[model samples]
Structure formats: structure tokens, C-alpha cells
Target: MRRDVTAIVRRRGAGHDGGRPAPRRHRAHGPAIAHSGVAHLLLAVALARGLAWPAVASQAEAASLAFPAAADARVEEERPEANFGADPGLRTDGGGDPEVRSYLRFDVGGVAGRVSRATLRLYVAAGGETADGPQVYRAGNDWREADVTWNDQPAPSGAIVDDAGAIAEEGWLELDVTRVVDGNGVYTFALFPQSGDGANFHAREADYPPQLVVATGDDRGGGPLVSTPTPPPGSGGDGAAIRASVETTPVRHGDDAADDAAVWIHPTDPGRSAIVGTDKLGGLAIYDLAGEELAYYADSTPNNVDLRYNFPVGGERIALVVTSDTDTDSLRAYQVDPATRELDDVTVRPIDVGIGVAGLCMYVSPVSGRYFAFVGDSSGTVQQWELFDDGTGKVDAAKVRTLSVGSTTEGCVADDGTGDLYVAEEDVGIWRYGAEPEAGGERTEVDAVGGGHLTADVEGLAIYYGGDGGGYLLASSQGSDEFVVYERRGGNAYVTTFSVTAGAVDGVSHTDGLDVTNAALGVAFPNGLFVAQDDRNGDDNQNFKLVPWDDIARAASPPLAVDTGWDPRRVGG
Candidate 1:
């Protein structure tokens, strides 16, 4: 017999403590274990430091207690290698007959205090209920919906948390997941059928997607746990998946060779702009606006690269490109020739960094007219070095400031317009600091993983410049194959998220690093260009994909600004 599990979340102001806290229940189906590691430890430390959750009103506060699915997909045994991430229906079946299973993930990071009750609700599709219902088990939260397949789906962890009996009709199915969902974080669940008869539910891409209802408890009572359906932010149509119009030639080295990229705007000809990319196994590869490789320089593992324009070197203005060399733990500098679109190695001497460099970005100070290179390593240590022209007309650097985070960090970018430095601590989130040397070690968190927008292992970061300090900060949500956009000014409010899907070129996935520009680069990309390292490029070696910023801007709900007037060359001036 199926157990009645309909839980109602009463608002605190209604004079109810949401009833006594529900008794702890767990169906011992698997080994009793919990997720651990450095990331979770950091989360514990963050909470201990009193990093407050979203404010809940003390009185009659109306807040959202229901959260939509963060990610959802199904894997079918018959098509083991194929991915059905775009499908609107999630399927599940067992007992052979082309077995299938559905995965669902929710970001419950907003829930605070003690969890009184949590329910997982799914909208059953018409004629979708089967003779045998499915069992739910806790699963890993790292899988992405866009590319997950039966061959690569995350394995179910722990034992069955709950199960349901045969449903006579199709409407809504609720499963008790309170045992796995304790407080605030990401939770993933997998459902597999008990019999050969399959069942279907609406996926996040379709109408009436899965929802998570959570009720938190305090002494006064529990807050409102409204079951009202509110679409998660940036949950739009195919328009959010922009297509790539151009792709750079695959790198000479294979297997994760291409790491990071930077765009160089032509001072005189916008059409002649170039892209500077780091080939970790090879060296540096320079490509023109059409994705044609102009030159290649062989070096030992160049992890990341960034460029600044109108730099005074050798008594003349030059476009400076800087890369962090992991092999030598040093800095590699290059000068971009506007006419030939080729890079000339301009390193005067070995500017050695004590730690291995994992990420690098160039910053031109608006206050001092000085150029700085921000380099970070795997240990979360970030060092700021001031770049100067040696008497020999080559580049030299002096370390000025050092900063630290809690975990591994790779991608980073410095805004020449606002003098702000943003760093991506892979498993943590994005951190913002003042670019000025004397700015000290104080920093602010722009966003964090499990906050509902970003997944773990956050990668690259790029800023889209707009007029009047209006722009967006874009970060690579590597775990989800999407990018989270936030307003560049003020509080860094979240704008939207978009993905690079297949179009004229293949889509981009597992992107390591990326860059953007607001300067119109000829007819090919009038509103500027976005370049990213694509880890999955069909059959060939890894390469970088290019998309026009205008397409992405117009595809957003309110439409992001397509400002071509923000000159990259004038940012430092």
C-alpha cells in the first residue's frame, strides 16, 4: 500500500509552528554516507563565519519557498551513447525492456534554519503513469542536463530514499526526500522504475516541470512554503542557446591543449582584430577575426592568456599580450603587430613566479597608467605584478600584492574600466577585489556555487563593457555547460544565463576560459565577438568557438545592450 505523504507548509503568521518537526525517517537501502571533501568543509566554515542566508522576514514576510528543478535529464539503455537532454519528457523503466532512468537536481541553498519538511513534486504527463512506480535514490549533483548520457550519467549514491506504488491516473506525484535534503545546498535524485512498465514526467524544459517544496523551522514557526510555481530566472526558450558563427582551427596539440583566450582589437581596422589563445602543450596561437591561425609560438604549457591595448613600450604604443607559463613558473609577454596580426615574444628576462601559474589576466590601471598582470595558482594564491618596459625595450614585472582564497582557482579577469579584479575559485565561487596595489586583501563574493545559478568548478570570467559603466560580468559555469551573467556595476545583480549550442559550428562544452569585447570588429562581428575554449570538438583536437555578442544580447529576455562604442583602447586612458 502507498503511504499518504501530502505535507502542507503553513505560514508562521497563521499561528502555527508548521506542526511539530517531522520525525527523521530513512529507508536503509544503501550505505549511510554523506558527501564530504574540501568544498563541503569550506561551506561549513562559511556558515560558521555567519555568512547569512537570504533574509526571511520576522513578521508577515512573503517569501518563495518553492524552487524549480535546477537540472533534469533522462538516460535510456537502448541509446547508451546518445543524449536526450532537450526532450520534454523524463522517462523511467526497469526489468529490462530498454531500461531508462531520470535524474533531477535542485538548488536548495536558499532554505535556512532547521528543515521541517521537504517534498519532491513532479507533474505526470498524460497517460504516463505505469503499473509499477519508481524508487528515488540520492545521486551526485555534478551531472549536466545538456550532455549527460547513460554511458556517462552520474552513478546513484546511497540507498533508495523513497518509492511510490502504481498510479491509476496522471497528475502530480510527490516523493518524500526530507531524509536527503537537510538544509541549504544542492540535492540530486535519480528515479528508476520497479517494473518493465515505464512512467513519464514533465522535464524542466517543458510545462509543469518538477518542483521542490521546502519548509524551514524556527522557534516562532515555519515560514511560508508556497507551492506556487514560479519559473526560475533565465529559464527561457532556445533563444538562450546562442550559436557560434566562427571556430578557430583545432590546436596542434591534442587532449586539453587549448586553455584560455584574449581578444586584440585593431587600433585602425576593426576587421583586422585578432584572438590570442594559449596552447598548453604547444605554445601560443594567434588567429584573425575569421578564425584563421596567423602564427604559433612553441612554449612549455601556457595555461592562460590576457591582453591590454595602448601600452607604452619602447617609447611607442603597443598591444600587450601576457600568458602564465606553468612549466617554468614564469611570465611570457608578447607584442601584437597590428598589420600582420602576429605576436612577437617580448619577454626581457625570466620573471619567475615562486608558485606554478594556473591563471593569468592583464590589467591596465586607470589610476596610475601602469600595466599589471594578475596570476593565480592551484593553491588559491593570487599575485599582482606590475609590468614595465625594461631599458632594453622588453617587458619586466615586479610582484606587488598577493591574495588568497579557500580552494583551487584558475580563471580571472581585471576590468580596466572600473579597476576591479574578479577571480574564479573553481569549487567555491567568484570573488571581486580592487585592482589597485594598495587595495589590500579585502574582497567581496559576486556569487557562489549551489546558489542556483552556478554549479561547481566555475571556470573562465569575462566582462562585457557598455556605455556609462553599464555592462555585464560573464562567468563559465563549467559543470553545467552554461555561462551566468551578472550586472557589471552596483551590486553585481544576476542578469541571465546562456549556452553555446550547435549552429553553423558545433556547440561549446567544458569550456576552460573565455573573453569578450564591445568594440565592433567589422561586418563579421559588428557588435563585438565572444571567444571560448571548447573541450568537446567533434573528432578533432580542442579549439576555440566564436559568437557575435549581438546574437547573445538580443536573445536575452530584456535584451542585453549591444554597445559598440565602448573602446577597449580607451579603457586605460
Candidate 2:
């Protein structure tokens, strides 16, 4: 069924001459109604195979589904980095005055059976004309709609799926794309023009949004196809989709390599701050604000890392970065070099915590001005250690206390100003405990998996500090691909939730760890920055994504606070 060249079909004008029934169109903003015949066939197959039909589809469309573009945008060469994701129309030109290219992404994970047919349907805008319509090609799924530019746009990776001839009139253009789409997962496509006249089409925001008609292989009865609308936000999360502004270099290793990240705010130059991350399969890496690697060390398998500023080490106050070295069931420490923006190993000796290190976070006590590290394991054992300068300018630690979270756990963070520690129990929820060593093992549940605020396997936990004790607690709801936000003070009431969709960079998914700061980091992040470890990075290895805190604040339903008064340097003061 692989056709090197497929003719593009228009729903209007000459398209009617083919004698095939014209597909029904859904004009309003809602789920698409399916063709009756195709729906019957699909339902028969699903029932015969004992498969669970998705509730999103109606009775008439059970077999076939219509998906609107999950993310779409056009990039113009003239304005390389300018984003046109919100534009009503998308443009594509074949090396004209200013070459323009368009990209579209579709998440087909909901499609149950083998895909027999998939059609990319687009509506030509009224004022545009094309001597030769754009050609469709396969593309990498790593680019985001909100921020994709000509410079960062993914190049077409496969042969033309279809090419339209002359299109003098405006109408619906359908391109058959069954070859590249097989089963459930994210798929990206690129549209490139074949002539100077180029063309314009309605974007996802327009009334005539782009659509994909998917027919499962079980549908033997061929009939006209209709589209299904993209599903709305889940009940557990607010449907806010924020795009990442920057992404760190992909880890050298693949398959669950990048595990966690810690933001290091520069003492004098905030914009020059660095991100220290872990490659669980290999080692640790440091990256600058531009997402370029600054340094990397393959000394140990560090699972999680956290840092605290102003540590009395080596006879001078310095910033310290620490990690749970899972390779040796010990802790590893590094001294931050502001001048080089790199790390220097400073672990005095191998301090074993007696359990396999699964997660780790640093704490600077506001009451005693002491620094501590909480090291935890998959078996739920957590050990607290007090780190101090070992008179010889190296770092050493003394075991202080231990606790049991009662389940498989990882991802933890400590609020230096409030003396509070938050831990995530993978299949369970988040728990809060006093960070001070003497506070003991007593803990309280913050939110649970079925509580509507979180889903199973809660991964990373981060605190966004605001002015006068006003802030928010962010947790990575891994199972749902969303981030749940809660009020920082009071009972930590649920506030809102969001997902990192594609933008200037690719969106984040299955995030393992994340960190945030309210300290303004120059013009790029005047309010602050939020960094998350992205589990999937297209064809490359996993990486970290950076989102401006203000973007999240403004994108929320009631809007989050855009506070930038807190200085990370004064955490324990």
C-alpha cells in the first residue's frame, strides 16, 4: 500500500467527480461525529476482539476518529526565531522571497488497533493561491508549535507523502498519509511548497482547523470518513499548555538516562546561572542558560542532585552541589566555580547511606544555619546527613536520622526558608515532613493519586518562592503528563495544573524531576525560570526543558503570582 506519489484530493469542486461519498464535516467546536457505516464496522471489530472502546468517541464514530492538530505552526526564514503559533493561518513557500515552512503534530496513542488509513485534511485560506500545492513529508516529533522558528524547525526526514498539483480555487485538501503512521505514538509532518506562489491554510486556532481522519485496520467496510476532535483537558488537571523556551543538550546516553536537574543561580550574574543534571546511566552534566553543555563528568551514576548557596567549605563560603551516587550507595559533592561555571569534586570520603540511593535533595536549615542532605531509596528508607567542611577544605557528612515513606519513592525537595521537606512516593502521592533532623519521621499527606489533584507515580517536587511566604508547590504528575500546582502556604491547597507543550523547543513529558526559582534571571526570565527533566527528546537522548516562570503564571486560569523579590542566595539567612 506504499505509494511513492499520492494525488491530493479536494472535498469541493473537482473532488466530487471521483463518485466517492463526500465526507461529512463538523463545523462547531466539539467532538467530531463519525460516518455511520465506518462506525458500525469498527464497533463490530472491537467487540469481536474484546477491546475497550474509548469513551471520547460517540456511537456513530466508534471505529474511526478525527484528531485536530495537537500542535501546529509555520516558520519564515526572514524572521528566523519569531513564533507564529498563534497565527490564524499557516504559510509555506518553496524558496521564494522568504521561504516559509509549516509543521503539524498528532498524538495517536489513543488509536487502539492497526491504522489502515489516515488522511491529513487542510482547508486552503480564501485569499491564497498556489501554482503547485505544498508537498507533505515525514518529520521529527521534537519541535513545539508555540516557539518553532525557521532556525530550529525540523527538516523533512522522508520522501514526499503526497504532492498536490495546481490549486487555483480555495477548498479542502486531503493528503493520504498511511505509510508513515502505523500505531499509537506522536507523529510529526512537514509541509514544503513546490512553487514560488506558495500557499496559505487555516491554522488550528481557526474555525476550519486542520484535521486527521484515522480508520483502523479492522474496518473492512470502506465508507466516507469524518474527523474526531481532540479530547479536552483531563479532570485531574487544568488544560493549560505552556511551551518550553529552551532545552538542554540531549544526554549522551539513551533510554531513561536523564533523571533530575538542579538550577544554580549565578551569585552576581543571574543570566549566567547553570543547570546541573544527572544521567543515571552515566554521570553528571552542567549546562548554561542557552542549553549548551558547560561540563560533564562520567565518574558516577548520580540519580538526583540539589544545591544550597553559601556553604562554609574550604575556608571560604561557597555554593555546594550534592547528589545521591547510586552506583556506590554513597553521596557525592562538588564545589561550584562561578568563574568557570563548572563543578570541582570535593567529597572528603565515601559516606555510605546504607541503602541504594534513589533520590536526593539538599536542605539549609533556617533555624540552625546548618546544611543537610536527604537520601532516600526505592524501599522507602530515607537518611538525613549533616554536611560540613572537614577542616582540610573538603566536605564530609555525619548521619543524623532516618524515616520510612512506606512505598517506592524518589524525587524530594526542601524549602530552606520554611524548614519543610516534600517527598514523592511513585505510585502514591506527595508527603510533607519537617526538614530539621530532630523533627523525626512524622509526615502528612499533601495530595493523593485519585484525589483529582494528582495521578499515580508522582515524580519531581519543586517549590516556587514568592514574596512574604506566598508561593506554590509543583509536582510532576508523570502518569498523566501534567504538573500539579498547589498553594505554598496554608494546607497546600490545590491551585492549578499545566503541561509543557511544544513551543520554541519541544514540550516535556514523563518528567522525572524539576526545579524553580523566583529570582529574576536577567531579561530572558525577568520573573524567574522553571526547569524540568524531559524523559523523551525525539530522536535524540533525553534532556531538560526550561520555561519562564512568568509564562506559567500568566497562562494559569486565575493566573499565578509573578513574584521576583526572593533571592536564592539568601536561602538560609
Candidate 3:
């Protein structure tokens, strides 16, 4: 391309040698030089129009774009090696040409923007004509140019970006493809007419190639600030899992039947605490802080046991321990001496379910100050009973309602503050229900039976309480030997999962049940502690392993919350 220019300059003799064109100069350069010259000429014109050239040039690439397309074809039958990408244009909405949809992909080369305008230009070569414009959609890149058939064409997104209207005479039909191309990557688009009038678009091999043009102006490239879930406050990956803060003395249950354990904190002294572990094949053993067996109540088979710090009983408050006794087929409650750290069988008649007991938990209502027990039996049924003072020294419970899982299930927990209960079906995932005494068995599955999140037969469930009804519900993913935690609020969205790897003490695997607390114990558990039954330790029988709650908290990316002020021991005391 060549151009002529004349400079009108007046000399001392006006019009004598003024405004005359010099001899034309021929220069040998490449297209880059010619493009620069053209750009300079445009810059001069823009300058005259009072425009900023740097701003215009920085947005230069956005001013124009061209792309070469590639796609799979009907090689075995039609002209496969012919190398045609998109066929001219698309005829959509039942336009009768085998329902053709042209897929085009191109790159934006990293120019960020909120598209103010976008257009897809396609050359209409031939075919029946219609007035309604074609629609464009983003598509997957699973198809190829040499092997694709109409039958195997990639399915385009159902979302319609630009619904271009009508192609009358069809030389060049432009459809707004703004929504089709946003940032980068081989972006894909599907073109189809709105109606069955049938139209054709020139292929990539045609002289007039398909082009996607997008433009954006002021206040562009702005969007909502999406973020990775932040770990709970005071939780950070600051340290590794240390040696066991304290491990219980080995149990004699030959088959690793140490099912579950709970921590009972003293009212006045935090360090004066007890761990109550169920020797499933034998009985219940209470251990003091040094892992020394303090007391043992053997004979009855206690599969799962839990304890609440304080229970208002018979004119005086006492800590209580409840267990699911398979032998008696009942939920048995006992009074715990907060000072002596001893357990006494407070023989209130056993809440009999008739089915052998499998798992059990206590729910003390933070709302109405009522205490209820959730008992589960091997017959695949769970019942909630409200326990109240019968004007006597004994505590008796009235059955509220019962729900069944239809499968062998064990291990459950009820959040008193939230009135929510979680039951783990051994071979299934954990299910959630309203823990209200009147709330029926309508359960919502928190985690399902798929993915690495949870393995079949989820065994244990625990909750780490935080202030303002915030906390984490931890599930023992027995199948994967990992514990998964979910936000206590909002559909229990997943937080993270971790395995109790080996340290000074052997790692824990095949965990049956676990418990967590945010209340500060001794210095060993500054952020509280998590006690889990280690089905596999050394060559000895299974035992309870104590892991610092802070270690678990710090290990999480978005760490779990550690409210040093929330003390269960002090809650009702």
C-alpha cells in the first residue's frame, strides 16, 4: 500500500516553491515497518482529534483480532483430510442442515476487561436464508477436525450468550459474541440460527474467515472478590503433630473394641479431668490425667459412652456419664464425682430400646435447659428421650420419637445449641437431623457415600464448638483413615480432612469414636484436645490417643476455630 502527502509551507515568495511535493522515495522494508508507518499516520490523525496516543495504542490489540480455527471432521465418510474448521456459518433452531453448529476457539492474549461490546462476524456463503440471527454458546474442546462426525459433535453450553437476529442477503452476518469470549485460553463458541430457515457460514478455509471482536471501556475488568475459605480465627499451620500429649494405659479388649471416650473436666480446676473409655468387650474404665486407670466398672458391655460436665440432680449438681450397654439393651446413666473424679451407678431404670445397643449420645438443650439422651441400637433404630427430675432422687426418661437407618449403624452426636444431630451409618455416610425432642426423623445427608471425602461406614462424629453458633462437625472417614470436618453452619460445607499420622505415639487408624473440646485443659492442650480411639497402635490392644487440638487446628489450611473462652466444663457449672 502506498500513499501521497503534501505539506503546505509558504516561502518568502508565496506559491513560488511552496506546497510542492518532493520526489517519491521507495523504501525496502517488511510488513512490520509498513504497519509502523500506518500506525504513525493514524497517531497523527488522532493527535489532531485531541486523543491520547498511548491510551489508544495500549488498547490497540483490542481494536482488532483475527483467528485461524481447527476442529474434527467426518474423515471416514466425507472429506476428512480436506482440513476445514468451521463451516461458514451456523443454521440453528431446527434449521434443516443436519443440525450444524460451528465451534470456534481463539485466545485473547491476556487483555483484561469487562466487555462493553462484542461481535462475531461470519461470512455467509450459501444455503437457505432466514431473518432471525443465530445464537452463539461456549463449548467444550473434546472434538477434532479429522475424526469428528455430526453424531460425535461436542455439546455446547445450554447458556445462550448472543442471540443474533436474522441473516437476510448473507454476505457478512455479525452476531454479538461478547459472552462467548471473556479472558483467554482457546475459548470455544457454537453458532446456530434462531430458526429453521437454514443458513451457511464460510469455513476457516474460506477467504472471509470468522472473527470474534470484543471491546471494553472505563470501569472494566472489575469483579467480585472470590476467595479461598479462610481458616477459622486463631487457627494456623504453625506446627507439626507432636508426641501424644497423653495416652491411656492399654486395654485388654483383644479385638480392639475400645469403642469411644469422653473428657469430663473438673468444675474448678481445668487440669483435674478424666477420660472415660468403653472397653466394649468388657466394661467402662475411667482414667485420670496421667493415663492411670482410676476406676473400672466391668461386666456390662458398654459399646459407646459420653459424659456431660454438670447435671442438676436431686438438689445438687453432678457430672454424669451415660453409656449404651449392649448387654442390658439400654442406655445407662451414672453420676460422676467432680471432686473425686469417680463414677457411681445412679440406678435410674435403664431406658430400654429392646434392640441391642450400638451407639449413644447426650443432648442437653441450651434453650429450654432440658436434658435428652439419643440412644441407637443394632436393630437399626435411634430414639430420643427427654430425661427430667421425677420429684425423686432417680432420673427416668420418656421416649420422644425414634428413627431408623435400616442398616447397622453406630456413633452419633447432638449439638445442644443448634438442636442438630448427626448419625453415622457404618456402611453409609453421616446423616443430620433436627435434634429437637419433637423433630421427627427427617434427615438431611451431610456427606454422601462417594469420593475421597468419606469412605463407607463412617464411624465417629464430634463437634468443636465456637462462639456465635460457629463450630466444626468432624466425621471419622474410617474408610480412608482420615477425619473430615465441615462448617457447623450453612449445609455443613466441607472444611478439611486430616489423618492422625504417627509421631512419638503410633498413628491412629480405623478409629471407632473421638471427642473434641475448645476448653483449655492443662498446658499440654492449650487450645483444648482431641481424644480418638486408636484401633491400631503398637502390638498391644487398642487404646485412646490424645492429640493437641491446636495441632489439628494449626494443620488446617483454613484452620478450625479455637475459642479459648468457650469451656464446656464451665458452661453449666
Q: Clashes per prediction?
A: 1, 7, 20
lDDT of residue 114 for candidate 2: 50
Query: Which candidate has the top score in lDDT?
Result: 2
Residue-level lDDT of model 2, residues 144-245, one tens digit each, is 788789999987753345565555434566665654565677778898876677777777765456766666633311243444332245443276776676
Tens digits of per-residue lDDT for model 3 on 297-354? Answer: 8857888888775677788777778888888888778888877787887757777866
- Which 10 consecutive residues of model 2 have the lowest summed lDDT? 1-10
**Ranking according to lDDT, highest score first:** 2, 1, 3
Tens-digit lDDT track of model 1 for 326-426 = 88999988888887888888899888989878999888888888999999998999999999999788999999999987778999988887989999999
Best by TM-score: 2
Which pairs clash (backbone N, Cα, C closer than 3 Å) in model 2? 66-227, 66-228, 144-502, 144-503, 147-503, 147-504, 426-457
Each candidate's root-mean-square deviation in Å?
Answer: 17.4, 13.6, 25.1
Q: What is the C-alpha lDDT of each candidate?
A: 0.75, 0.77, 0.63
Tell me the deviation in Å of residue 56 in model 3: 43
Q: TM-scores of all models?
A: 0.60, 0.63, 0.57
The count of backbone overlaps in candidate 2 is: 7
lDDT (C-alpha) at residue 144 in model 1: 90
